[model samples]
Target: MKRNIVIATLTAAALATGGTVAAFAAGDDETATQRQSSAGTQVVADRDDADDRADDVNDDADDADDREDDADDRTAVATGDVDVTAAEAIAAALKSVPGTAVSADLDDEDDSGKVVWDVDVLGGDTWHSITIDPATGKVLGSHTEQEDDTAQVRAALKGSSVTAAEAAQAAAAKGAVTSVDLDDDGGSRAWDVETRATGKADQDWQVDLNSGKVTTDRSDDDED
Candidate 1:
């Protein structure tokens, strides 16, 4: 009889997360019955505990969805002068605060008429927006942007042999590299760079992070 009671209690706990209750009852003489009767037996569950467990499961699922949304985010197309490469500006920003650069833009501010390197860096779950002077590599100012999940970003960059700085450096041979962004839409991470030169159309280049090879991307051309 005690054995049956213990089994019923354990069954209740297992069903608590599903918001269901199992009802089980048996007399001492009922144990003499065939084991087939246990098949339909129900076990009691704590209703309140079941609701709480269900809520916790929902919260976990929502958190996972939020992280996935952040993982596929894209940055704006940024332009800058070739006098200071994107790699140099990023290097300058990291010197001010140690972190990884996820995205960067060379902006010619319309209101201030000043060109600066605006970089987004990720450190743990925190994000920082840093500005640097393109000409002198001076730290202009910086502030906390927001929080982000670094799990996906870290995994994507694990196998990348070429850093963003190296990709920009390799693109210099093609033209004045303006922007260098990390891209992994094709299942592998690569640095996408933009460049412009006199009497030539603005060109987009991709630096294979694994092989360190520079190639022209015609996708942008197809859009035009």
Candidate 2:
């Protein structure tokens, strides 16, 4: 009977140790699962942060492009206003002349804050002229002559070499002379005239009023 009791006690002790080992294994598995979950959350957060940074960079680029476009628009508007003022002045000057209709275009080459225009004066025909000013929209001087009336002016241009009326008439045949004035440029006689001419193309002419000669001839390219 004593032997039987000893065997029963040993079996009970063995069962208790096995139960303790099972509990420890369950705890370790739970800890490992928690660690894996934490690592996954960190990876997701990092990806979100990178996406936000990329969006910010794109926004900055768009803002810079918008500023540049605004600046270009402002510059164009300013240039257009100056051109309008110049055209009005030439039109006013031509109105003083009989049987002539005058129109003006801006000259981009004369950007020295100087008002320069390609003036077209049409009467019996067309005459082109260039008008210049020291200040924007202010007419300082002008040169103009005839284009189509070449034959008449060439014929009349003979005799005495230079006559204001004859030269004026030649200029008129091509178009019309809106303004004609004579002046001395550094002791050299200079004639300043404004005219508009027409051919296969419409153009403006600037004539030396003193010499009864054409100075500069400009076409539609000077307009916009």
Candidate 3:
């Protein structure tokens, strides 16, 4: 009777402190087992949700990277008429002259109508003109264009950061870059780029070296 009275007093104190007492014997606790199962299920569900979210983020990142890579590819080789790209032509020219490429033009106006990439490189005091096959990307021929005009070309290229390949890429929006030239037209030195399409007339653009900006330039049709 005394032990029962002490237990009742302890129960009363617990209740007064807003505490509830619970006890479950091992191997005989169905309610506790059910609570543990429910908690395990909730944890699994949360982990699965986090994993799904991470997969979605990775997928999005992969898609974005693919799009950027595609854009870069298009910018470099969007011209469908020729297989040899401006960048390739510039690289070929550099291999021959080991200098800075100043101009590259895709020409098909020869007597036999052979398509070739004409690349001009500035090597020290000489300007080298290199010709490469459009289909094979092989160097066909090379010649010295001029030796005295290096000073003029150098002056025009001073403080210029945009290269011939970069100028071609800038103008390769709707078509492939047909020609890129370092020019000082209109008193401002910049790169003059021409893009050619299949059925449309060629378009001209001026690429500024100081800021990598592209703008419409004087077109050949403007003479009319």
State TM-scores per candidate: 0.58, 0.32, 0.59
Q: TM-score winner between 1 and 2, please give it.
A: 1
| Candidate 1 lDDT tens digits, 1-224 | 99999999988878774444222333434655654465435222356668889999999998986554322111112332324567888888788878888767676543255666777787667788888777677888999965544676777678678877788889888866667887856574678888766457668887897888998887777789
Please list the residue runs of candidate 1 whose C-alpha ends up more than 4 Å from where it truly belongs after superposition: 1-82, 147-149, 222-224
Candidate order, lDDT descending: 3, 1, 2
* Best candidate (score: TM-score): 3
- Higher-lDDT candidate among 1 and 2? 1
Error of 2 at 99 (Å): 33
Regions of candidate 3 where Cα sits further than 4 Å from its true position: 1-81, 219-224
Score candidate 3 by lDDT. 0.76
Best by lDDT: 3
RMSD (Cα, Å) for all candidates, in order, is: 17.3, 19.5, 18.9
In TM-score terms, candidate 3 sits at 0.59
Q: How many clashes in candidate 1?
A: 6
Better of 2 and 3 by TM-score: 3
Ordering by TM-score: 3, 1, 2
Q: Enumerate residue pairs that collide in model 1.
A: 22-42, 22-43, 22-44, 23-42, 23-43, 24-42
The local lDDT score (0 to 100) that residue 115 gets in candidate 1 is 62
lDDT of 3 by residue, 1-224 (tens): 99999999999998765533333244347778989999999999999999999999999998986666434334334444368878788887788779889889876434244557889888877778899876678899998875666777888888788888887877778477778898865587788887766556657888887776998876555776
Better of 1 and 3 by lDDT: 3
